[model samples]
Target: MSNPFSYPTTPHVRKHGPAGYREWENYRPWLRDEFDFRCVYCLCREKWGRRRSSWVVEHLVPREKAQHLALEYSNLVYACSSCNSAKSAKWVPDPCQHAYGQLVYVTNDGKIHAKNADGRKFIRTLALDEDDLTNYREMWLHILQSWKKHEPERYRQCMSFPDNLPDLTQKIPPNNTKPEGANNCCYQQRKQNKLPEIYG
Candidate 1:
């Protein structure tokens, strides 16, 4: 349950068109790969979230503050809408610059505990320990526990994949069969620059 990196590795941001939300939407597929199709803050996936907008393209620096970089790919992050909204226009340590795992830990029951002051600030700023998020993470933990108990092989496959729950939902095939490409669906989709079914 202990994750090593505070933030996932930063993906290369490809340059895109001039400033606009539409232009950023085009970069979602690429950004998804960089973020492993999970929210940068909460690590939720659109496939498993209650809302389709659970994961979205967020600007690390608000467009209102830095209009010139509105379409700058490097500034973009795929975050759950709730986290993005909670973070609205506030400046915090950049995940890329600040180590998150060192600052906070999500307990077995899903409450997030800050390891230090900055971690506390980050958690408080984003409401990382809010009831809804805690409950959601607890549910995921139960699902994972169930998978580990009842479907060990599947659980291992899912656990081995870096994308966590989404890897289970989108990439790992069922025990009895394989997909057409002999690959995880997400990998093929990424290869084709195709967004997931939800995005369609």
Candidate 2:
């Protein structure tokens, strides 16, 4: 079975470049699709809990530090509330520029191990190795494993994309640098039957 906790092997390339949203909150839907409905830092999925309440639109560079980029699409990321709070005003490697899978690894025991200094800092900054997070990861790992083994349908539901994929085509940002990306959004892919049922 595919490990749901595995991180991306390559740095994320921006698929959407929406701009001119006055409030960063307006970018939540875009960020959700861009990051595959998970926390960019910790890999927490939207399926795990209440979506709107649990997830947040995070700034790659904190607003306090870069006020100009507060609404910039490139500077936005999708993160869980816990990771966002832990990373408040702190700098770590950019997820768009770094392949986290190369920097860190999540073991079967639910412990996160860093492969280098950057990874170490990333984990520390986000408190990714804390007891609470480890316990959370371990619990999910076991649940997913059991579901995959005994209840394949439930496992597919947990591993699959959320039902309400945002329709990016209807959204009109003031300026979209990559207008073509809208066609590749998860909603569009699902419409075309191009989206995979389960993402590893």
Candidate 3:
């Protein structure tokens, strides 16, 4: 089984680029799919808890720091409430431009380790190594390992995509630079039976 907490080996590439929404909250659905239903910073999945309330839309540049980019599609990311709050108004390396997998690694004990200066900054800024979160990761790792071993079905549920994937094709932003991206949204792929049941 793949480590669900494992970060991407390469920088994230944005798939959906919905733009010109009056409120940033309107981009929630798009951000959800864009980040694969996980917190971009912590890899916390929607499968872990209450779907809607547990997640939030985070600004990469922060609204107070750069009001001009507040509504920019490229500046938005999906994050869990914990990470969002911890990272409030602080800039770390851009996940889109920097591959976090290269910066940090998680041990079986659930402690996060940094590779260098940027990695250290990322972890420190988000308090990723704090006891509460470290223990949380450790607990989940054990739980998932057990589930995968004894409850295959449960493991599948935890590892699979949520049932409520948004249909970007049905949404219309005020202006979309990548209108063609709608066709490739998760909902569309799932509709065509191209979506995988489990993600590594």
Candidate 4:
């Protein structure tokens, strides 16, 4: 059985300012912690992307649909650029409550299997079967297999429960200054590049 704690259904306890200038900055850390730095859809991380901004605060229910929930912590999701762009304004099975093993499973072929009709719809909606994602999962599978064989201790640690997980934190110099970028413009760029427009 998949670990329940692997995905979150509850909102983080951290304080997040209302949606305004740089409000997401205050909530980013909380979302990161809630999702364990993985995309709710593809499980991708900023570390896997070309930029730290690759992962973003995607609204589970798009702000266009529910403007009131724009900054509602419970409605926020941590998603990678591709998944976020693909899921711009559509609804899918909530990864938190609906991501149990049967609904979404990884097959031996390193493909994501949406076991039910809803799962199939979700997969189709997000194009989760794309070759790049298949190959990405396969690569990670191989790496995991190698780790299990050659680095049992590390593998065990990686497989441990979230509460039992070790502290992998590292200190970095503080930067309280805000970045000069308007983060939301990336979605417009993606749409202009002929990516599917979900909001329209």
Best by TM-score: 2
How far does residue 174 in candidate 3 sit from its true spot (Å)?
Answer: 1.5
lDDT by residue for model 3 (1-200), tens: 68887989999988888889989999999999989999999887998884225888899999999999999999999999888988999997788999999999998898999988889999999989999878878988899899999999999999999999999999999999888888998899899999998997
Error of 2 at 130 (Å): 1.0
lDDT of 4 by residue, 57-147 (tens): 8888888899887766667777787877777788976655664344566664568876688868887777777888777767756655677
Runs of candidate 1 with Cα error greater than 4 angstroms are 1-22, 51-53, 153-200
State candidate 1's TM-score: 0.68
**Candidate 2 residue lDDT tens string, 1-200:** 78778889999999999999899998998999999999999998998884225888999899999999899988899999989999999997788888999889998878999999988988999999999888888888899999999999999999999999999999989999999999899999999999999997
Q: Worst lDDT window (10 residues) for model 1?
A: 173-182
Which stretches of candidate 4 lie above 4 Å from their native place?
A: 1-22, 46-53, 151-200
Q: Candidate 1: what lDDT?
A: 0.61
Flag regions of model 3 displaced more than 4 Å.
50-53
Pull out the clashing pairs in model 2. none
Per-model TM-score versus the true fold: 0.68, 0.96, 0.95, 0.63
In terms of lDDT, the poorest run of 10 residues in model 3 is 44-53
Q: On a 0 to 100 scale, what is the lDDT of residue 1 in model 1?
A: 35
**Using TM-score as the measure, what is the rank order of every candidate, best first?**
2, 3, 1, 4
